[model samples]
Target: MYSIHRSFADNCMAVTAPVRSKGRFTIGCDIIEADKLSNRLVALLPKTLDLRAANAVRLGLRELLINAVEHGCLEVGFELKSKIAESDDYLQFLLERQKLPEYRLRTVQVEYEIRPQRIVFRITDGGKGFDHKHRTHKAREDDALAHLAHGRGIKMSLRIFDRVRYNTAGNSVTVLKKLA
Candidate 1:
């Protein structure tokens, strides 16, 4: 397995990659501060992944990072009304959360296992967990206004992965997709 770690100079954050590999890969652990995730994403794009999978990887990673930072780390109930008031409200909400002492306690972890046919990406967050059953059912029904704002991530993730699974607490998600 390959490992990489980066400590952001701008903020109270560090990005650590404990494991990364292409063939027969396994991502053991990665800890990234919530505030620096986007910057890390920008830095990680060209180095860690191939060009062919970059777009899908970026999209998937963006959503996962947002979910981890917003809902998981901040414990903000996903609210569609706030989004309607301001397109960037979700981002602002995250920024506010970062100013809080609680944000310092949050970290996002991504683990993976690669096989000949597929790759599995698992993302875990440090936060109060949500009920997976209720969230999944709400997602399936697609009847809530919050679904309009929050549902897109799940839809996008499903398109990018062959299969997706969430832990009972909804703080972790596993995505699997076959290699081309």
Candidate 2:
């Protein structure tokens, strides 16, 4: 049996469930501030996690969260290009985004479920969604750019997760990583 309890912290609502068995654990659903979600996640990571795996998870989560914040929530796609450009070019690009005031009201929902076998993370945002089918197909078909800096987060996520799926609207991603 699962019991649900609702609470609030840091200006966000949370639903939490406590597991009754040794192998099972806690499940948490939270609506978080987009700007601080990554820091909260980084603080929550278990100390015993494998260094490489933990790093990959951290990087992937950070990038996705940033994408959701800067692009999805703020409707600022040009900010992403700044991340990929040369230092001088990036600085100029960032300056442009900084002048816009559309970044004020963005938020994201981050859900976490911890079980004995794996950890599941779901991140959802409010924004104009994308075409999941097209993105998935493109990732699978592109091989010549294996080591390219672009889209590395999605690639790393596919490799690390036991299962990964996106919501129909493409605004949410669910990832499962088996415990080592």
Per-model TM values vs. the true structure: 0.63, 0.64
Tens digits of per-residue lDDT, candidate 2, 26-117, equal 11112133334554553455444544565566656666666565455655454365454635464454345534555444456678776656
Give one digit per residue, the lDDT tens place, for model 1 in 55-174: 475567667766766667667665643554366565555556566886656666766564545566677777777776666555555445343535566656766767878987789888
Could you list the CA RMSD of all candidates, in the order they appear? 8.5, 10.0
Worst 10 residues of 1 by lDDT: 22-31
Q: What stretches of model 2 exceed 4 Å from their correct place?
A: 1-36, 77-101, 142-149
Name the weakest run of 10 consecutive residues (lDDT summed) in model 2: 1-10
Q: How many backbone clashes does candidate 1 have?
A: 0
Q: Could you tell me the lDDT of residue 153 within candidate 1?
A: 65
